[model samples]
Target: MKAIILFGHGARDARWREPFDRLAELWRAQHADVPVELAFLEMMQPSLEEAVATLGAKGAKDITVVPVFFGQGGHLRNDFPVLLDACREKFSQITLSTTPAVGENVAVLQAIIDFGASAL
Candidate 1:
């Protein structure tokens, strides 16, 4: 009964969501038991609450929302808490939790560094 939400700060360009879509596909492919959804802070479909509802419908009681942003900027630091609170109030039956922005993870930073080095 656990699910994951990959939350991102959306951009206006339609193509901006391609990576998010791919991430969802990869998650589904690798972790078949846990359902995953992509959500956005703006300019995208399936807002965080909507993603939560989708997972809830799938019988997910515990949900972990991973902020896909590189850093804990304003949206992640300020806007996200408000949105998460709203979702919690609305989806009282579901347990909602979130992790720090992806960029804060050492593995991700190392991957970025490796990719940069590979380009040289």
Candidate 2:
């Protein structure tokens, strides 16, 4: 089976995870066939490894991680590779891959711009 991990940069406030939770809910609702999990780089319940484990338990052999960040900052560019490498080492049976940060997509940026325009 295939699974997805919505990866985010965790914030200090617990409430900061609300959006991630909503994203997971949305994914589950829309894509019931594929399993989804939320993972944070810090200050959260399940780290990347834990998320991978959860999917592995569900019998997921191919896992794709989507970085739900606004840009390819240091966290994505520097820290993420190390975390992914660790997960690979820990879960050698699973095929783990990652997508570019959501912010890198032009459509996503356009949507943000459209939202800002609507607010103005």
Candidate 3:
């Protein structure tokens, strides 16, 4: 089965992951057919490797990683590719793919704009 991993740059504060957790929950509710997981880049648990392992054990073959980062910054450009390569090597059986940073997406930007506008 296909699965998805929401990738984020983690913070030292545990509460920083709240939005990611909510996104995963929302994904589960909306896309029951595809499994979802939240993975972190640093200062967090369930790194990309662990998340891939979890999905692998759960019988997921194709997994797409969506970076929740605000932009294609150094972390996304440099660190993320290295991490993804490692996960691919470690989980050879799984087909790993990824999308650009969420903040760059049109829908995401619009949502942010709408939210800001709503406050006015």
Candidate 4:
């Protein structure tokens, strides 16, 4: 089975994970067949490797990681690759890949614009 990981940079505040939780819940509700996980880069419980391992245990052969960051900053450009490489090496059986930061997507940007317009 294929799975998805909503990857994010963790924060010290516990409440910072609320959006991530909501995203996973939304994914589960909308796409029940595709298992989903929430992984953090730091200051969190499940690291990327842990999330990938959990999915692998559940028989997910292919996993796509979507970075929830707004931009392709240093964290995404520098540190993320190292973490992803580690997960790949650890979970050789699973095919792990990542998408660009959500900020890079035109649709997402348009949605943000629409949201702002609705707010106004």
Pick by lDDT: 1 or 4, better one: 1
Tens digits of per-residue lDDT, candidate 3, 28-75, equal 999999999999999998999999999999999999999999989899
Query: For candidate 3, what is the TM-score?
Result: 0.98
lDDT of 1 by residue, 7-90 (tens): 999999999999999999999999999999999999998899999999999999999999999989899989999999999999
Candidate 4 lDDT, tens digit per residue, 9-61? Answer: 99999999998999999999999999999999999879999999999999999
Error of 2 at 104 (Å): 0.4
Q: On a 0 to 100 scale, what is the lDDT of residue 79 in model 1? A: 97
How many residue pairs clash per model?
0, 0, 0, 0
Candidates 2 and 3 compared by TM-score, better number:
3
lDDT of 1: 0.96
Decide which is better by lDDT, 1 or 3: 1
Question: TM-scores of all models?
Answer: 0.98, 0.96, 0.98, 0.96
**Candidate 1: count of backbone clashes, pairs at least 3 residues apart or interchain:** 0
The whole-model lDDT of each prediction reads 0.96, 0.96, 0.95, 0.94
Give model 2's TM-score versus the native structure: 0.96
Query: lDDT of candidate 4 vs native?
Result: 0.94
Per residue, candidate 2 scores C-alpha lDDT tens digits across 2-118 of: 999999999999999999999999999999999999999998879999999999999999999999999888999899999999999999999999999998999999999999999
Candidate 1 residue pairs that clash: none
RMSD in Å for model 1: 0.5
TM-score winner among the candidates? 1
Q: Regarding TM-score, does 1 or 4 come out ahead?
A: 1
- Alpha-carbon RMSD of each model: 0.5, 0.8, 0.6, 0.9
